[model samples]
Target: MHRLELDGITKQYPAVRANDGVSLRVKPGEIHAVLGENGAGKSTLMKVIYGAVQPDAGTIRWNGSPVTVRSPAEARALGISMVYQHFSLFDTLTAAENVWLGLDKAMKLPEVTRRITEVAHTYGLDVDPQRPVHTLSVGERQRVEIVRALLTDPQLLILDEPTSVLTPQAVDKLFVTLRQLAERGTSILYISHKLDEIRSLCHHCTVLRGGKVTGEVDPTQESNASLSRLMIGAEPPQLQHGTRPAGDVVLAVKGLSLAREDQFGVDLKDIGFDVRAGEIVGVAGVSGNGQQELMAALSGEDTRSPAGSIRLFGRDIAHHGARKRRHEGLHFVPEERLGRGAVPTLSLAQNTLLTRTEAVSRAGWIPSGRVTALADTIIRRFNVKAGGPGAAAKSLSGGNLQKFIVGREIDADPKLLVVSQPTWGVDVGAAALIRGELLKLRDAGCALLVVSEELDELFEISDRLIVIAQGRVSPSIPVAEATIEKIGEWMSGLWAPRETA
Candidate 1:
């Protein structure tokens, strides 16, 4: 008998039919993958099954019996649990506290802590249960979500874009955990745009396109091109990389140091780097290793640095605000898309006010037409899938939102661009496109600083690389000289000290 099943599922929002006649079945001890492009209805279907959204038409079966999951709690009670793509975590709470809130059992705080640590170790997630969720990195917080789901001991597990924030090593560890869970009779429904991961880890695959099921097959038996065709109805564009010439220094930092703003935050010490015009400098580190703090300082979100610490085109702007820095020919694309990069409640055209105020405003009043025109340009340039410029930012998928954000900054023609996690949560093809755009920007005489956990991405586009560990920047090296082993060592603060003359 199938462990979990969905038949004739259909979901309708005011503007779109998110899912149409979607059906899926997962046998016991199987890992089933749902593959699709951004905004292809994968998330909507999963939300319907998890009771986060009510399907307009469909029947759900668990263990061969029709059931109605009216709420997430009801789904949990029915031995079904889902880990959402966008995390639902309280930043102020400890890991144990966050898990305890989702759990049904009447366990004490101490017991919850014990259980969290035990499960973390068992699954090789290695999270600190006592650590505050606010202090954790994106990858660590993702582990918390996974551990929370595992503690439920559910008969079926649904993971949505689970590895989007994880490092390559962490992804391998998660696959091991999932394989173990499947061996113990736990069925998994994995949703992701990463075709290689789906093919390697999943036994079965279902592809969706325009809110409809287009194909179902064994993932291991299908090529990447075949799967892309099923999901997008066409082949994704190829990403090409070429050697770009370098120019004069556009951004330079020397002896940059700052104390922690928060009581528990990491302090940056003696950080230094430089990026030349027409070159890309990539900063690589494991999540939580000062990347956030560094990005903030560079982006002018946290401009507490002393005078002369940071220089843009030989000008001291250590105390400048974000807007001032932007006016000084510096642009930034933040990591968090919803609340940081773009406001969730605002329409895409209105959200342009967040960064492109001058472009969309005249005589101190916002021009709706200019804003719409700019947003339309972003959509066309980045190939963002949305209803139109009037659509809410939250209506778009993570990948599409990322493209929009990056494209917005790149279109401004800044002298220096600092982007964090340029393609996080993007599909392979989209990721390639974004990287290619960054390289093109570099080739066009724009200095770029890219901070990402993806080693492959950094190595591919960066002319120079630096590893940030515990809020300190390591020595920078040319891409030709940097190796994965050496960079990984730097991530852990294990590199040799500078030699004395």
Candidate 2:
């Protein structure tokens, strides 16, 4: 019997049809994949099912009976729970506290903490119950979300880009947990842009495009290319590798060490690396293993480092602020796109003025025309599908916002660029385009430092790679000489320097 069913789901927004006559069903013990590009209606449809959004027209059947899921509480009460792509966590609250607030049950703080620990242990999603949400790394925060969803013991669970922030080991653990859940008669609605993951984990898939269902197939029976064709109507262009040699070192970090700012945050040890002009250096690591700390030091978000630790063209810049660094032709694209990268409440046009002051008046006022023109250029050039330049940053889908931010920085023609998770939550087409753009920037003599969890992405665009483990960095090695096994081993802090060898 179908565990959940939707028919004729139509959600109409003022600027777009988020979901247009979409329909799908899930069976008990089924691990169903909802496959689509960004803004392709998969999220909207999932929201409709979970009661986060109300469809203008649709019939939702629960266990063979029609029902109206009026709110998240109602959905949860009906044995449904969801984990969002962008976390909805309270920065001020601890992990246990956040999870406690989500549930309808009343439990003592200690009891809730104990339950959290139990769930984390059971599911292999390690989380600290006492760590404040803001203090947690992106991957840890993701674990909080997953653990919370699992705690509900819902018959039907909805996971949106669930593994985006997790390490390979953590992802494997999650897959095992998901498989176990499926075997226990709990159905899963998995939403992700990782096609390989879907093929491996999902038994069935529903493809969507432009707010409509396009096809249904058993992903295990289909190839990646076939799935891409179904979802995007064309094969994504492969990013071409470069043949250029690296130039003089544009960015160098030597003996970079800093105490953890937050009580639960990771401390940077004697970290070191270098990025040369005309080459992309990829930093590989588990999420919490000092990437955030390192990004902060590099981007001038946290400048508590020694003056000589970070050098931009042989000049100490640890004292410079983020804007000052940007002024020096150093640009950064943060991993957290919503708040850190783009203000949600601001219009796209206004956000353009955030980094590019040229979009403002001579007196520093936001010039509407110039801002709009700049935003439009970025949108059009990046192939970002959004309402318009005047649309709020929160209005566009996650991928569109990412595209705009990346395009904004790339358009500036920076001498050095530091980007973290450049393709998180982005579709295959957008990822390919973005990766291609990064390579193109490198060819233009831009020194690029990339920090990513996807090993394939690192191999694709990087000329050299360094593994960061437990706040310490391994020696940089040429990409051609790097192996997944070597990088994977070094991710645990086991690496030897070439000079030492």
Candidate 3:
């Protein structure tokens, strides 16, 4: 008998039919995957099963019996737990505190900490229990979410884009944990856009598109091409990759060191690197190892560095604010898309003003028309799916918003572009387009500094690579010479930091 089942589920939002008659079933101890492109109703259906969103019409079954899950608490009580794509963690709370809050059973703080430690060690999810959520990196934050859901001790678990921010090693560890859970009679509902992951980790797959299930198959026996056809109805785009020689240094960091802004954060120690025009430089690391701190320093979000620490085209702009950095042709696309890269409450056109200022009046007034025109251009050129220029940034799906923020920055034609997780939750086509655009910029003699946890992506476009671990960077190496084994070792801080210019 199926452990969990959804029949004829439908959910409607103000502007979109998020889910329509979506049906799926998960057997006991099975790892089932839901695959689709962005805004294709996968997340919505997961939310429905989790009881975070009420379905307009549907019947859910738990253990062969009909049920109505009205809230997350109710779902949890009925042996269901979920880890959302966008984490629902409190920034000020510690990792253990966050997990304790989610769990239903009463337990002391020390006991919860012990359990967290045990689970983390067993699953290869290393996280400090006392660290605040705000101080953790994107991948670390994801670990917190996973640990929290695991502590719930549910019979059915749903994970949405769980590995989006994980390193390759971390992803492999997660697969092991999921398989173990399934072997112990815990059913898992995995939702991700990564076909390779589903093929390797899931026992069954259900494809969603336009708020409906388009296809279902045993992903293990299916090819990537067949899955792509069922999900997006087309082949994925190919990247035009070619060699681009490094030019004069566009962004240089020397003796860059800074204390953590928060108590739980890692302090950067003598971080130094340089990216040149016509080349892509990639930073690889396990998350929470000062990736956020380093990005903050380079993006001008944290201006604690000395005047001579960071040089943009040989100019001392280390202490400049974000606006000053952008004005100097140093554009940044932050890792967090919702509030940092783009404002959630503002329309896409209005959000463009965060970095673009040419449409601004001399006295600090913004012409909405110019902003709209710019947004329209990005939407057209990048194939961003949105409800025109007036759509609120939060209204779009994660991938679409990612495309917009990336397209916005790329359209500006900056001399130095610092982007983190450039294609976090994007579909195959969108990811290819974004990478192609970055390469185009490189071919046009522009410098790009990319910070990503996905080693494949780094190897694909980066001309040189550096690894960050425990707040320090290893010696830079040519991409042609870097191997996955060596980079994985460096991710553990096993490699010593070396000077580079």
- Model 2 C-alpha lDDT per residue in residues 1-501, reported as the tens digit of each score: 799989999999988999999889999999999988889988888889989999999899999999999988899999999998888899999999999988866777888899999999877677899988988877778889998888889999999988876667667888998999999999999998888999999999999999999999999999989999998999899888858978999998998899988777788998888889999999998778888999999998898998799999999999899999998989999998888889999988878777887566678677677778888999999999888898899998999899999999999899999999999889999999999999999999999999998887999999989888888888888888888878877877778776221
- Which of the two candidates, 2 or 3, achieves a greater lDDT against the reference? 2
Scored against the true structure, residue 188 in model 3 reaches a CA lDDT of 95
Tens digits of lDDT, candidate 1, 100-168: 988876788888889888988876675788888987766678888988999999889999878755556
TM-score of 2: 0.97
Query: Least lDDT summed over 10 consecutive residues: which range in candidate 3?
Result: 492-501
RMSD of every prediction:
2.3, 1.6, 1.7
Candidate 3's C-alpha runs over 4 A off are 496-501
Where is model 2 more than 4 Å wrong at Cα?
A: 361-366, 496-501
Give all candidates' CA lDDT scores: 0.86, 0.89, 0.89
Better of 1 and 2 by TM-score: 2
What does candidate 3 score on TM? 0.97
What is the lDDT, from 0 to 100, of the residue 56 in candidate 1?
A: 92
Listed in order, each prediction's TM-score against the native is 0.94, 0.97, 0.97
Per-residue lDDT of 439-484 in model 3, one digit per residue for the tens? Answer: 9999999899998887888998899999998899989999888889
